[model samples]
Target: VAGQFGKSAVAAAPTLLTKELTFNFQQKRSIQLAMVELEDMPVRSEAEELVFSLLIAILPERLPEQTQLLSNYPNPFNPETWIPFELSQDSKVSVTIYNVAGTPVRNISVGYLQAGSYVSQLKSVYWDGKSDTGERVSSGTYFYQIRAGDYTETRKMVILK
Candidate 1:
């Protein structure tokens, strides 16, 4: 509270009147803490500083890491197949199954997933040789792709009748 900006630092922060205590990085090179309370409530100064510093320090490591999608198991699958992959960091990901002709068939995941290796079994939703609409058809080769953050990989499989 007593460095580059001078004692008037507290007065300059009109909008920060709501900052449980404001640290103005733009106005000064050093840090200063003011007792100005946002509401009539109280705050634990040490706890707030600890939390803020920890978050600021970890910012560089928060990005999702790279990953690889492994090939599906039982290449000539009939009723089901297991797809596996690995991620080096936490990420939002999705595994999509596609027919031989390149049509999205099913979503193996519904939301974000954690980092690490994973394997998911996809049931043959319509291997009656048809798609979701309920018509009979033929199949030879199909594919599935796993997308994690900015990384994406597609692997092929054979579906035989």
Candidate 2:
């Protein structure tokens, strides 16, 4: 009788004590059903524990690695230069040239490479002083950056016409 009156009043007082009791009762019923089936699958927890133990035992034996790029050549070049770098891991690499004002002028590399040292020639790219679209670039300082994996490095060069 009381449960029926409480259920009818729930349409108006949605958060009455009876509604709270009903929600908790359903949750307890579901938990009881789940526990009734747990005895057949105890190995899941054991396997998870074993994997975690192995990872803890082996992870400390590894070392951190680093990647680097040696400074470029012909630092103050007229029409040509060279940029070199080394990668510690196989990575997607990009080398970009930018003017003193930080605008990208040329893309020297936009490709993937294996781990090793490499050199790139900047022949058609050097300042006869010209831009990528072949407009005459002014004599000024320019910068280039090499990006390999998670590493990045920048260096400056000069253009003299």
Tens digit of per-residue lDDT, candidate 2, span 1-161: 86465433433343343334332434543433343334335565754544433332322122113567666677677766677766656778887889888998887655787554464563212224456787766678988888888888988888776
After best superposition, candidate 1 residue 38: deviation in angstroms? 42
Q: Any idea how many clashes model 2 has?
A: 1
Error of 1 at 49 (Å): 33
Q: How many backbone clashes does candidate 1 have?
A: 0
Model 2 Cα shift for residue 69 (angstroms): 2.1
Positional deviation of residue 42's Cα in model 2 after best superposition, in angstroms: 41
- lDDT for model 1 comes to 0.54
Question: Which residue pairs does candidate 1 place in steric collision?
Answer: none
Runs in model 1 lying further than 4 Å from the true structure: 1-66, 120-137
Instruction: Give each model a TM-score.
Output: 0.48, 0.51
